[model samples]
Target: MRVDEYNSFANQLQRYASALSRLESLHIRLADGCRLRAYQKRLAQVTVDPRSAIDSQLVIAVTYDLREIDEVNEIVENLPATLDSETLTLLQKVASGSEHPDDELDAPGREAQYELYLGTMLRRGGIPARHGKPDLVATWHNKEFFIEAKRPASAKGFDNRLRSAVHQARALVRPGIIAVCVDQLVRPADGLMVVKDFNALAPSVDNLVRKFVVEQAHTLRKRLSTNEPVAALLLTARVPARIAATGHSSLGTSIQLHPLLAGSIEAKFASSIIPLFAGSPS
Candidate 1:
């Protein structure tokens, strides 16, 4: 996505959020939706970048990071014995927040975050959404749609991963949202397919990113064209940095999608997800 495109997306979301807030409140059973709504009340939060840390106000709780349990235990062991319980708790929380940020996020946490992302994105398109039993359900054109999102480790088993998500969406019995964070998108024929190998801007035109994005987009268009139950599939891509550095992938709003591939996305999803509130989006 270009800078202007991302900006436009965010701006549109704010407008939708404001519109929904004006509606007569309805009873909703979605716990996740409730929390997100409360966090983004009045469309108060704004994202400068998708990859940056989320604003504190949008998160209901500050979770303790336990990714480095050994390191955390070592810190705990060295604490002074005379410290009061409250003081020790505060210290541990601080250390966990700073030193062990990735620990507590298992698959569920990641899925929950992407679920939040989708609903957040929908609201950006002026759709009202909530999360509960079926991951998420959003309102548009006076109709409710179910959205299910998944983050697999890599694209090696893309079919299997999507199949699992598809099953979940099928159970929802509504216009379903299926989203996938592109962990590893590669054909089985490749030999050394690291994440970095796929770069659209690479000197070699046949880079991995281009191939994967095109193939993935084709797969999605074909699936949607077949009268599949899913309304849309969101594929969030990431580029992991070098190994010696943190084993983290930096995601950005600047998703440099291929023109042909992104058009497939616009046709399948952007065209339908918020049609009631939007005409053809750029």
Candidate 2:
């Protein structure tokens, strides 16, 4: 994503606050004492102060909270006037508690959010898509494409997650792509991504993501070699970063496409669809 396109910390916070208020007014059943609600309350207590000393833990929490809110807002804003049962169910799941204790980024809720996020992005890219049985079903150039998104909390579980997504994608009658959020795989230690200037943010983030992708190129190639239905591995990451120059923080997102092979049918499909998802060539 471009630097100017990134949402400011204050903007994201305000967006979340408004979203939370709207949900409350609608009588949506958000979890009692949800961490997201708490994060909003805490963030409201202070303004962005670059020099202010804040706990790294709070920064991490706020970063994830803002990203989640943005995702939820995207999904909500794009929904059709009449809500389908499937979409409603997915929203409810997102509103539920985190899948694991003391961790809001785990499976179930975050996982559902990721699916909706992907669908939203695809639609924004002018591809007709929606969250469904195969995680996502999208149409481009009059052809349907199935997508399966996964968020593995750790590297140890990545293989299994990829395998599962591949299985799901292969079952579909249309072409498929496996999208994985590799945040945990490349995330730095808490508080490590403090940048000094806005100009440096994008390069710093790109370097981190690129380095990881390069290091794992062999492993990724090995894993996707035999997965015929899977046209490509869409690896994505969102890192929480603090900008000392602005005294604020935001999530930096990076996406990379690793095709199964060059000059093949699947590779062509992946190349054509990836620009839509990434908003540019990956």
Candidate 3:
């Protein structure tokens, strides 16, 4: 990506973060019967950084989505206040735009967002998390788990996607790298399809979702070949993209974060932007 495009996307990512934050607040208002004016105030407090230039349309859409959120409880119950601030940084190299179709770049963009959302979730689980050489870096008890998330163009393509992601992750040759494929689970069979042992994390919605993903991590850890232990998983977290909310006043889109997983695999070697090492590399 050109320097200017990176700067622009960085800005868009920030707006997504800010909008997501405000949307969370909006949901809280509906849940508690509190006034939403607080969220509006927060929106006003955020002044767009000129350095991170994003499309004005996205800003407008997010603002509108915040104002128009119905099914407030569904969102309030499901949404988590965990968007990685690291998403706002433009650190990696982008492919040459001239070499790829415009649509081809969208996957990496979504993957970046996925990394931020997943990274934040890890942090919430008491893991020190951030973006790293693999995609996401999670620290727990002095060990690092390098996680790579793959989002195929659609949910049906998960098999191919996981295969590819595993190949990439296996190539890393790092001690703790974990590769996970992210898919969408809207049907019971979808969950079963993603997690070979999906039923273990059941009896509740959250447990079922989380356990299924975690199981994949355990599976991949057992399956892959490495001098050190690694993990591979299948994470199903997407759904058909539709407007979460709509309003004549403003237009916006919703970014939802959901289940994740990891496991092991075999493959070629690839270098990471950040080297994998034991413990926190301060």
Candidate 4:
């Protein structure tokens, strides 16, 4: 995506978030509807780049501001040690503000940093994180808590790494992870539920984020070479069931993938038997 386009998307998101915050304090019937219509109107004012080059409905490009990264780094640094330490360290390294950082020179480098940051954040927040090859072992709560992180919102290109990663993650165990992908607008139709006319509804943010993660996960697994043992998940700002599958492959056996909220990863962990690592702070 072009710099100007990304800026427009970012600005619109900021406005939507702000509007929702204010709407929360008001008491009026159909208030959400009014807010959504206003948000849609404002969004229409922004220039949205065409998705011709990128087939996915999520945000086609991710625009990052060095200043914003710095601010996030400051917040992460100050988070309580009660959060995962290793995960925090990883976040600091990936999300920390840097001037013309090396990763900025290439798409792969940028994607790696984002994946690392997200992986770390999930792990730090008590969810397990791991990379697929080079002997990185996958572990889950009683073999129930499993997840995958994707760069749909940040990466360019139509590579199948997302699917590959999900397949690798599925190798861990039966009833394993619910793979996850991160992107904006899980699907365009999803926008209609959280947004009306043109505005975002105040109560939809949490649900939207959750669905984005779950659907991405689900999509990754559905394309797997073989049936996945676990379910799929898309976690983003919008929730849609588009990625959720109704049945399994030609194996005459059904493999079920689950679409869940990324935040709900914590809840899944709380109910799992997966062994927590010693260095884990959570």
List the global CA lDDT of all models. 0.40, 0.67, 0.36, 0.34
**Can you write out model 1's per-residue Cα lDDT over 1-282, one digit (the tens) per residue?**
311111232443454354333321222122334433333332244334454666542321211111112112222333333444432333323211112112223344334444544554565556666556666666656766666667554454566667777677657665565666553343123221123322321222124445676767655555454455565555444322211132221112122322222344322443454332222121
- Model 3 scores a C-alpha lDDT of 0.36
- Tell me the deviation in Å of residue 161 in model 1: 2.0
Specify the highest-TM-score model's number.
Answer: 2
Assess every candidate by TM-score: 0.43, 0.82, 0.38, 0.37
lDDT of 4 by residue, 1-282 (tens): 000001234444455455334323232122333423333433343335453443333211111122122223333333334544443343334322222222332233233444444444445555555543311223445343444544343323213645555566556653334323332233343232223312222233344444544645555445543454434333322122111131100000011223333335533652331222112221
Count clashing residue pairs per candidate.
7, 1, 19, 37
Off by over 4 Å in 1: 1-106, 183-209, 213-227, 238-251, 254-282
lDDT of 2 at 136: 80
- Kindly report which residue stretches of model 2 are placed more than 4 angstroms away from their true locations once superposed: 1-5, 21-27, 47-60, 97-106, 217-219, 261-269, 272-282
Give per-residue CA lDDT, model 3, range 1-282, as digits (tens).
000001122333345345445554443122222223333333333344454554554444333223212212122223335543344341121111111112242355335435544554455445666665667666655755566776554434545555555565656656444443233323243222122222311222334346544655544444444433343332333211212232112111112222122222211111221122111110
